[model samples]
Target: MRAIILSGAGRYADPWHPYAETSARLAELVAAAGYDVEVRDDVDAALAALRDDVDLVVVNAGDPDGPVPDGVEADAQVEVDDTALAAAMDRGIGVLAMHASASSLRDYPAFDHAIGARWEPEVSWHPPFGEARVHLVGTHAVCEGLDDFTVEDERYANLRLLEVIEPIAEHEEGGVRHPLVWAREFGRSRLVYDALGHDARSYDSAGHRALLARALEWLSHVPAPTADDRRGAAGPTSAT
Candidate 1:
């Protein structure tokens, strides 16, 4: 299977995220999961490369609203066009959106719907970075058989969700639990949003790596819904 990783750069890059480091780690995991991986740091050109032959797209980008490096003007930064990327999804390519990617590709408003969530600047935030406890939730292929694990990473909370996602993993903050990892289908495309992978350290966790491997495997092989299954299915709702 061919997997394309869109590493953050230019307008999609921020000072806080080590996009290259985390993306390299992601490449290792994806390769281990049996994918021929390609990493591209130029967000715009990378999105344009999304074609029918590509099996998966891993989004390891930074928040577009975050602080840029010194001497870089935020407003003046380049905006990306996701035309090919969107069309590819419609053609049934899967997506795995990593941390901070929830806020990436904001130039396309449909991005929120694509990834199933959006990181609202003032509303969505994370606590201090450190070892965090991630609890496995329902029985889903992506997270099934995995135990709760702790890893050094930032715990994102209160992200604005745009769909009824089936959260397979979550983390607690201020006595409230927030979905940290979830799976959903976007039109014909399968999608998984992982709220981990802040840096290489986060990938060091065996549980985290296993989770990602399973996510890749699952994304690679999604069965199309049968006519009978569709007829018996409950319609979409505000929650899963």
Candidate 2:
């Protein structure tokens, strides 16, 4: 399977401030999962490159702080190129959203369609920094190999999850419930969204890694190859 990771959104203004490292780590994880992965910061180029070779697109639409780049309009919380992204999704490519990505495509219909949910800031503020246990609520492939787990990090609250969801992880804080990870099918592809990965520790969390691995495997429609497939083949290194 081939994958493309779109990161470094902050680079249009400050190259050093780009989250390229985080995105690179994500690409490494995907590559280690036995897929060819490429990382790019240019949104247009990323979309253009997805014309045929890409099977999955992992967009880390970073924080919406810097000014929108040339030829890209900032509409609500979504960038103008989001329409093109929707066009790509419409073509049946698997899409995955990470961290603050839920807030990136705020009012775009295609983004909503691709994400399978809409996020509202009023309802989705988790403690700025804390620990929350994630409860698995389904048996979908995205939740495969993972059970209930806990991670200490920022807990997001007040997210309006899509109606069609096989929740893999639910966050409970102060007796209130919120979704942390979930999977849903869109068109002919699978889409998974996880509200984790706000910090380095969250990304490094074992449970979160497992969830992401399973999600990638599910989205690519490629089962994990057996040990024998690794013999004389360029297999992915262990990510665990």
Candidate 3:
């Protein structure tokens, strides 16, 4: 299988995150999952490159609408068309969104729905980065048979969910359990959003690696059902 990783750069780059380093780690993980991986720093270009042969698109990017810090020259505003990406998903491409990617690509209005979630600024925030225990919350092939595990990373708290998603993992903060991982289907596309991977350390966890590997394995073969195909079930399936 083939995978294209959209690594953050230019206007999508942020001061707080090490996008390049973490994207390199993600490339290694994706490659180990049996995919021929290519990493691209340009978000729009990568999306434009989406084709029938690309099985997966890993979004490891920063928010384009976010605040820009000092010393970083913002890239000129470039025209972005979501037509290619939307068409690709309509054709059953799998999406693996990581961390702050929940907030990336805001220029594409449907980007949040495509990933099944969004990071609402001010409303959504995280505490200091530290060791966190992630708990499995539901039954899904991506997380099946996996136990809760700890990792050194940022816990994305209170992200706004945009779709009916099955949350498969969570973490507690101040007695409130917040979802850290979820899986859902958008049209014919299968999507998984993981709110971990703040840095390379987060990817260093054996458990985290295992979870991501399972995600890749599932993404490589599964075709999520469209809305019409989900109507008569007991409840919405994870892929619906």
Candidate 4:
């Protein structure tokens, strides 16, 4: 198995801070899952390399609007090409959309549709740090071994959820319930989005890590890790 990580934009721009560290740590965890994981900080390069051999694609949200960097451009066609590749890969592959990734491709309809939601300005984080209770609502393999649990970190609001979705987690705040994690199928492809991973702590949380790992495994159809796989499992280290 092989996974490609795109970690070079939106809130992830660099001095190699927490976001970068979290991405690296996530890649390491993917590697530990018995897959050859390749991480590219350049969105264009990452997209270009998405042909075959890559079993999964992980896209990190990057800078909101500071130019598309060296490899990536502001071209919609490029975005469409990338989305098409991802969708094709999804026939039997996996795609993980992290934190701001939901908010990353506003201009690309294919990407927005594939993700099952488009980020709106109204969508913002609730409290920089707090314990959010997430309720599981899906029966997919990704939710296997996962129960309703709480994570200490940021929560998102005002997401425009598309019609196609199998919600896996929900959160109620101020008496309003919202979907926190969900899975959707797009033309034979499996797409999972978690509105968490906003910080290092959230990514490293045991519950969150397990959910992420399971999501990847489910999308790739890899056998769920058994007790033996967990024996020497190394959780992500601090990216600070």
Candidate 5:
């Protein structure tokens, strides 16, 4: 299948979270998974590549330095080409909104529908970057053959959930469990968002890397690993 890794910017960039390096690594990761992967930093170029044959669009960018919509105002401004993006998604292209990408394209409510969640400034907060334990919330194929694991990255919280999502990973802190990974459906398309991966180092965790690869496979409707996909999360399985 053909996949695109569109990235370059991230929210409040810093030395520790080099978006370019993270994007490069992720591109290679997806390529290793047997996809004809293309990496681009331009939204128009990426969107332009979404054709009838394109199977997946993985958004890894965030324009924290961008501007808010003409009328809406916010602390950090991250805009996206919601018009073009929503069309592709509605037409059944799989999407993976990773890390800062979830917070991207804030001005467009269409993005909320496409991503299933959006970053709510001030209200949305993350703890100091460190080891975060993400546990499985359901028996979804995206988390197939995966177990709860820990990673060193930004743990996003207080996000504005736009729909009822089937959470796959999360952590509990201060008596509240924040979802770290989730799967949702939009129109004829599917989406998976993993809140981990603050930087290149975040992929060092084997479990995190596996989840990324597996999520792509699931979103693309590729058969997921089934040998041991049933060992985690004591809950009802999807009866599909």
Candidate 6:
């Protein structure tokens, strides 16, 4: 499989600054999985490079703090090249939007159609980053034999989900539980979102690494790879 990681923004991992370091580890993991991986900060270059052969597109960047780059469209930071991105998704490319990415395309409804959710900062909120226990939703391969795990990361709360995505895991903050990991179906492909990696320290968490690794496996295995399609489950099964 081939994958492209789009990252680089002052706010992608805002106030934490983990994208650079953690993204390196992510690339390593992708390489270890035998995928031809390339990392780029230019979304336009990514769109140009993407082809039918490419299996995955990882959006690790979010709304920029300063002016959006030239050749790229932006009405402030709430901007993304939706036409290019949506076209790729329409052609069956898998997507993995990590951390701040949900807030990346907040202004583009077309982008939301593929990503399944949007981060409307005005309404959505998360508490300070801390050690939070994350509960896997079910026995999906993404968390196959894993048990309840904790990670030192931001507990994302109150997201705007345009479509109903399968909740893979969740966490409780201030007595209120919130979904932390999720998967969505877009056209012929699939996308997985993991809210665990807030910074380098969070990535260092053992359970976080396990989930991230499994997430790659899950994202790559698109269109329901096996007979046990977790998408059809009415609710989360027993956690392993």
lDDT per residue for candidate 2 within 1-240, as digits (tens), equals: 788887746433222223566677688778977788888777545564456657787867654544555655543343345555566565667777776667654434665666755556567566767666788876776766678777766666777766677777888777877777778766555678877776567766788778788888787762333345555387567788
Q: 21-74 in candidate 3: lDDT tens per residue?
A: 999999998999889999998788778667778888999989886765567676
The lDDT per prediction is 0.84, 0.67, 0.85, 0.68, 0.73, 0.71
Residues 1-240 of candidate 5 have per-residue lDDT tens digits of 988887643332333346678888888878887789887765544564457677788877774545433443334433445566666665677778888877664554555676777777778888899887888778887877888888888888988987889889988879899888999765567888888888877999888888888887778762222334434545566877
Evaluate model 1: give its lDDT: 0.84
Best-to-worst ranking by TM-score:
3, 1, 6, 5, 4, 2
The TM-score values for the models, in the order shown, are 0.89, 0.76, 0.91, 0.77, 0.79, 0.80
Flag regions of model 4 displaced more than 4 Å: 10-17, 66-91, 123-125, 222-240
User: Each candidate: how many clashes?
Assistant: 0, 6, 0, 4, 0, 0
lDDT of 6 by residue, 1-240 (tens): 889887754333344445667678778777776689988766545655557678888877766543443444443443345666666676666788888777764444545676676677579888887888889886566778777887787877888878888888988867877888888775667888877666777777788777777888877765443324455565566878
Which pairs of residues collide in model 4? 9-62, 9-63, 10-62, 10-63
RMSD of 3: 4.5
Worst 10 contiguous positions by lDDT, candidate 1: 222-231
- The best candidate by lDDT is 3
Q: All candidates: CA RMSD in angstroms?
A: 4.9, 9.6, 4.5, 11.1, 7.7, 6.8
Task: Give the Å shift of residue 92 in candidate 5.
Answer: 1.1
| Model 5 pairs in collision | none
- Candidate 6 regions exceeding 4 Å error are 10-16, 65-84, 107-110, 223-240
**Residue runs of model 5 more than 4 Å from their true location after superposition:** 10-16, 64-83, 107-110, 222-240
**Winning candidate number (TM-score):** 3
- The lowest-lDDT stretch of 10 consecutive residues in candidate 2 is 10-19
